[model samples]
Target: MNIRHYFDLCVEAGGQVFERIGLTDDYRASRGTGFFTAEHHIRYYAETRVGEEVSVYVRGVDRSDKVVHMVALLVNDTTRRLSCTLEIAAIHVDLRTRSAAPFAADVATAIDRELAADTADWPVPVCGAMGIRR
Candidate 1:
């Protein structure tokens, strides 16, 4: 799949997991803010072919005063190959004020717990044709 597709899939899967665990009310709501303004940094180690089953896994999470950090691992189930690794930093801001806020402790805890419990299988070469690493 392409990088854009992969990113969408990851967001979708992550959103689903978050919702199932009561972390989010909806796709947009899960982001804390209306939607995430993400800064994604990704590295591709391999590639995945069509018809292969890929899995997205959350590897870690951290919270600073203004941002929530997530590390995701995408692996190819068929090839047992690691496709890409992503470090996403999403900040929580008041839309009206356009100012950052300290990440909620409850949200941080939930993210941390879910990430720690994550052990999903993944696909290979998680990135698209683009050479972008972040």
Candidate 2:
């Protein structure tokens, strides 16, 4: 599979996680705020060809005042092998000012809750310098 596919899959999965953590676009839009990717690290472990379906698993890894780090895993269904891992650090931004901003109280609490849950359930792999950046 193309490397771009893995990136897209990670973003797709991250979007879902954002929604699950009460960070939907609509909510952000109402507040004139949004999340912008500040950094990304993709670790390729295996290759997949066309017609090979994969499943994506994602979770929040960590967060700072203005940034959130999330990790995504893509696994080949048939082979049951890890295909790729994408870690992204996204900044919460104020749309009008176009600058990084802290997340809302409710949103921050929700994300923390989800992060705690994910941390309890999943073994966190080393996310590298990019993840540590935030």
Candidate 3:
């Protein structure tokens, strides 16, 4: 799959999480710019063919007042193999000031709850500082 397709999967899965915390419509309506990606990383393990059954597994890796980080694993269902992994750090922002904005108390609390629940069953380690030596 292309890079955009991978990103789309991440967004869709992340949206579900946000929706549960009551940040869906509000986030969408803030079209002017509500959030920005601070970092995004992807690692590929295998290729997936068209029409193949697959699943995207999302986990909340970490979060703060204005930032949330997540990891998503794309797996081939039939073979039960990993296809790729995506890590993203997104920050809430204020469009007018183009600056970070803290999430609401409820939103922050909800995120913490989600993180705890998701972390309990996390399947993969959320990697950091990836690279290779020649």
Candidate 4:
């Protein structure tokens, strides 16, 4: 599976949830121009195939000034495996002055709520569990 596709899926899924809860206007509007900056890091620990149903669960969100940081986990249903984990940091800024905007309280709340909901039952096997000849 392509890692970029997985990352895009997570971003799109998270953006939808955020919009549903009125976190930001829209992802496109929030991008570039210093309005919003997202630095995403994804780690793929296991192999995943096509046609597998996956779900992205937000784990946490943090805000400092205009920056909003989010952590999320992606799980595959077929194998009940964690396909990848992502950490994203987004900054909110003013389009006009190119300065930081006051952190939106609603955005923060929505992010936290999403993360809490998805992290309920996380199952990832430890490295020791995978059998390998020493």
Top TM-score hit: 2
Candidates ranked, most accurate by TM-score first: 2, 3, 4, 1
Candidate 4: stretches off by over 4 Å: 24-35, 104-134
Global CA lDDT computed for model 3: 0.75
* TM-score, one value per model: 0.67, 0.90, 0.82, 0.68
> Taking the tens digit of each residue's C-alpha lDDT, what string does model 3 give over 7-61?
6876787777778866766664764336687877888888876678889878887
Which scores greater on lDDT, model 3 or model 4?
3
Is 1 or 2 the stronger prediction by TM-score?
2
* Stretch of 10 with least lDDT, candidate 1: 124-133
Candidate 2: how many backbone clashes?
1
Model 2 lDDT, full chain set? 0.83
- Give candidate 1's error at residue 80 in angstroms: 0.4
- The local distance difference test score of each candidate is 0.62, 0.83, 0.75, 0.62
Clashing pairs in 3: none
lDDT of 4 at 46: 70
Task: Give the per-residue lDDT digits (tens) of candidate 4, residues 17-42.
Answer: 65665655554366433335456667
| RMSD versus native structure for model 2 | 1.8
